[model samples]
Target: MKTLYLDAFSGASGDMFIGALLDLGVDIAQLRTELQKLPVHGYTLTADRVAKSAIYGTSFDVVLDHGEKDHGFIEHHHAHGAGDHQAHHGRHLHEIVDLITASDLSATVKRHAIAIFNDIGAAESRVHNVPLAEVHFHEVGALDSIVDIVGSCICLDLLHVDRVKCSTIADGSGFIEVAHGKMPVPVPAVAQMLSDRAIPVQQHPEVHTELLTPTGLGIIKEFVTEFGPLDAQSAVQQVGYGFGKRETGQFNALRAMILTTSQSQKQTAVGHDQVTLLETNLDDQTAEGLSFAQEQLLAAGALDVYFTPIQMKKNRPGVQLSVLVPPVDRDRFVTLMLKDTTAKGVRYTTFERTVMQRRFETVTYQGLPIRLKVATYQDIRRVTPEFEDCKVAAQKLDVSLETVMAAATALAR
Candidate 1:
């Protein structure tokens, strides 16, 4: 499996993440062309090699155009000085969603960008005690930050990263200024987002300034699937450093790398990873309640949730609720299981499982697009058509579902 690991020893920001991807060999011109699909304007993207404390890396910046001839609107806005920039560029969540949804960019890119913005918006909404729709994105909604968020997603797509892993994030202490006045390090929104997701964070008191920005946290929260040290057995394909603007009296950069782990390395079928299994026995809960709890657990990010019939004490029929979740999310899921269900206690165990390498391909059947999930293990491969796509094609072609699925499966094979 191919994985992208981010070593945020210093910290991360939207610009820093993009710079790292660019340094890792994402084509700058292609990224620019892809970003042009968005309706946003009044900015120019620039990237250059920069050094921080003897460490060299790429520094990407989105310079808002204030030239009289090129951007009369931005020039007029700039004439009011930095104080009014927020008022001029600040956008609500729905507005940003509309902008991304209307773009001609690839669906994957659009989904990623909007998800990041939605997370940030949710954090901001919680912090300010405002409705999610009424939450205004002042700094993140600016032209540069928008480019940073969306541009980072575009680069990841360009790289075809299968999974993202991050190290323990290092954030600083003290206060930083925001449009809402001075806020403590990590800020309210960043803190809220991290805590809500239970993302691991570390504080570096030596550097009394904010290291992690809200945009950075949003990006990490949206894409990163795992958090821990890099695997020692994996092979490192390439490494890139993304320089930050901070002067921390030490190297201030985010290290990103591409890593590959093959089946032969671990003598496994394809790949192996650890997961947390949570189980609870329930006999007092209603069917309606159990169904609702299952829905809630799935929505809360549980990898899998199912109920199995089992006999319990008192000679009564009962069900065993099992949930699969990432290790980092064990506590969060445990809390949800306890709260959303009638179980008095939940048991969890860590299990190592091997999984097949999976990839997706789209095929046209009867003029309708059907997606195939291809999984590989050693020299063996399995192809399965996506059920939803097959169902749609069957309805559109006035054919049976099984026929559409079989045809799609054969085509994929």
Candidate 2:
């Protein structure tokens, strides 16, 4: 499977992501053509070359023509384009999506683009205590945001990779000023968006000032399937840097890694050394739906899936849909739920995990086949029958559990 690994060493931004996509072979002409569908009063998606710390790289910029703003046009220093401009602050998210839908873009791209914004809109609503339709985007409601969303969809579709993964986002430390006044590092909506999606994030003390922006977070929250070191299935074809504006000690470089298929299948590792656990309530779904969802999640690359009964908000009882996936896959799983069931919320957090090396062996008992689990420790292999397999075999043979156990023991010896 083809894969792309994101190395967010410095941080990520919408524009820088576009630049990186361009560097990784995304057709700029195609992106620019699709971006023209936004139907904004007047704006153009422009490409340029800019230098960061004396290193020259491609930079994608959004150029706005005078419409209803204060200046003849808006020009910002950051490559991602200026955040929700002062004039466009109070517009509704649906209004923005509706505008994008009327554009001359592909239906698939348009649908994914809208879903990406809806994810951000939902985050803003939950954080600000308002309905999604009433939630006013602060940083992600601008025309530039539309370009980022649509362009990102186009780029990913062009790459045609089987999986997308990321490293634990370095949400730098320190405060950033927003329209709502000075807010702490990460701001409220951005932090809540990541947390609500069950995505894993960490902070670096040396660097600060919102390394992960709402737009950047929204893309990951919408597209990536798993988060871990670049255990990719292909060779690294290209590396691109999407420089952030702020300087964070010596680690102020935002980088992305793009990979293409080199062989039928290969392994690549590139993420943080942390683990995350994601769970959601599922009382309203049918048993069939729940079962299907579990199968789908595992098929979508989940590490594990299980259920537990629990009391939810408002004294409601429901089965908790728990999933153990790499932090990056968290978003993909969430998307899975949105499409598969009626669950309204999902919860997740970082947890410590220890993994042992594994191997498989076959053992026979009275001409019955049994699969064995083997673990390696200090170069020694320990073998044991798969418990569930033994139980099924015992019932089919009409034998006692002890009979199965004894048979397994004799075979191992």
Candidate 3:
């Protein structure tokens, strides 16, 4: 099968991702024609080979026609300079989903686009604690992000890529002021998205700016299977670079490479990522307190959490708390661990972990929500519903949890 690997040497954004794919030989005219199927209007497509920091690559853009009156183009408010020419861009998650569903795009392309948008919506929902459908994509719901997403999908379909892998993602540090006041760099949605997955990431040492956008991370999360450098077994077929808007450094570009992979490599490439492992010892905390602490750690962007039984100093039985997290989220989670538990200190280490590429599907049982998860390996494929979703259905049906789980399992099968 064919494979595509992304090299985010500097950072990534919606424009950079699409631009790189265009440089990888996706026909520009055909991409424009495919995007025209969307119900959105008042925007013109633009593509060119641009240079940043002396590096050259294709730059893709969706130039909004704010002057047009036919598509209800109202003057958008850019309170913090994010709305200057970016007017009427904010739309709810459900609205965008319905728009894509109504478009003339192919069913396969539509599914890929919606799945990406769902990822972004899920991240926003977690960051704001709002319903998935109710999350307003203030920055990503705009015309360019919409085009970037759909156009990327169309190009990938045309290229016939079967798998995707990426290098360690690079992001910036410090604060970024946007439409919703000043937020920490990387943005809450981007940070939350990185936390939810096993994608390896690092902070850009020089620039304190918004390097990776929420839309960009969402796309990466949906398609990228493994995180790290590509293996030497695959033969590279093509190479392309997508330059970002910034010209501060040579790392301000994303590189894409097409490769021919052997079957053995595909089976072994499912999940490989770098993460930080944090541990602490606690003896005085109650069971209820530990449960709440775990929930808070998850919300604060922990990858995994668990406890182990151990004998502390003086023969006292205690629990050893373990937290798996991304390096970018180390400080925040560490603070929570120190504050929430009686432990005055913590121990941590960084290592690489491999996991299977997972997919999520939501099914409804008599108006109750049930989520199905699919995983891939060498020859084994696993499908199961999220336990929490099954629990809720069980309560609604007044049935045993195991019975509800089995019913959901049968439906998934």
Candidate 4:
């Protein structure tokens, strides 16, 4: 797929995100024209070539009419403290929603922008222990922040990125002064935003200031689909560096790259991935216990759990329990199997498996909506009606399950 991978080794900010996209070949003139759709004013968007630690990148800034500007990095050397803006205009969640909703931006852009703002509002509300509606945004409410958030969305639309992945964000140590006094490096708002979404983060002791801002976290939370290193199989199409205004031991820039993976290159319907196969033979386990254990394993996120009839040593008819689990959850499933079943040990093997691309389509059959699971591999297509839906239709229509399934499958075809 067309993927955007963000190497947030230096951390992220809204302006940094926009700058990176601009460097990735997002048209600056087009971005400026799109930003004009918003009702707000008094800010000039500027993207300039800048150098951080001797590495050149784009530095995006929002310069307000009052001569106050927004910086992507938070350091004591900068003007209005951390997240503090001299022209800071506080806005409520509803007010921002109304502003975005009334704008001439596309529905997708508006939805994404408003959703990011809502998440920021929720995080701030939770941090201050106030209701979401009553939470007044300080730094994020500024006109510059609004542009940063909306402009990031606009750039994403321009790039037509199918997926967004990020690395573990590198925050800094030590405290920074904010409107609520000196908070931790991440500050309460940034911490709350990451914690609420379970986003991965780390602290860099060498840099003692805020690197990840609330605007950056909100944007990441809204757009990023996965977090990890880039896939080795993917080809790097382009690379862009957006510099932050911090001078650290390392380069203060967020590296964004465009990647094209095999998943997008092939027209075939099959996809391949690695999965763990967990197996354990249980001879002393009771049928009832095994049933309960199977249910628990499935509930605990095992892809599949099945029991096989097998003959153990001494001609004992034992049950072979096999569990298919995502590689990440293999250890958890193994522990559960050892605890819940009579098996003293569990064995796991990683297997690379190929599977058809699956999608669902809902069709009306006899006034009943039936969902058909369609699996495609190469030119082969398999259509099967969901059992529950077919069962409901069979009961209501006074027909056999097979009849209902056949009709639904035909409609799907």
- The best candidate in terms of TM-score: 1
TM-score of 3: 0.59
Residue pairs with backbone overlap in model 4 = none
lDDT of 3 by residue, 50-143 (tens): 7765877888776777742111111122243555443356677778889999999999899989998888777777777766655556555776
In terms of TM-score, how similar is model 1 to the real structure? 0.63
Model 1: colliding residue pairs: none
RMSD of each: 14.5, 12.8, 19.3, 17.0
- Model 4: per-residue Cα lDDT over 1-413, one tens digit each: 47899999999999889999999999999999998989988988889987766877899988888776432222222255466554256566788889999989999999999999888777777777777765566566778889999999999999987569899999998988776578898878888777756788999998989999898998999998789997654789999998887666678889999987542222334489888999999899988999999877765556788999999999999999999987987776888898899888898899999988876679999899998788898898998888899999999999999999989999976
TM-scores for every predicted model: 0.63, 0.59, 0.59, 0.62
Candidate 1 per-residue lDDT, tens place, 255-334, comes to: 99999764323322347889999999999999999999987776555678999999998899999999998798898789
In order of listing, the candidates' clash counts read 0, 16, 1, 0
Displacement of the residue 42 alpha carbon in candidate 4, Å: 0.4
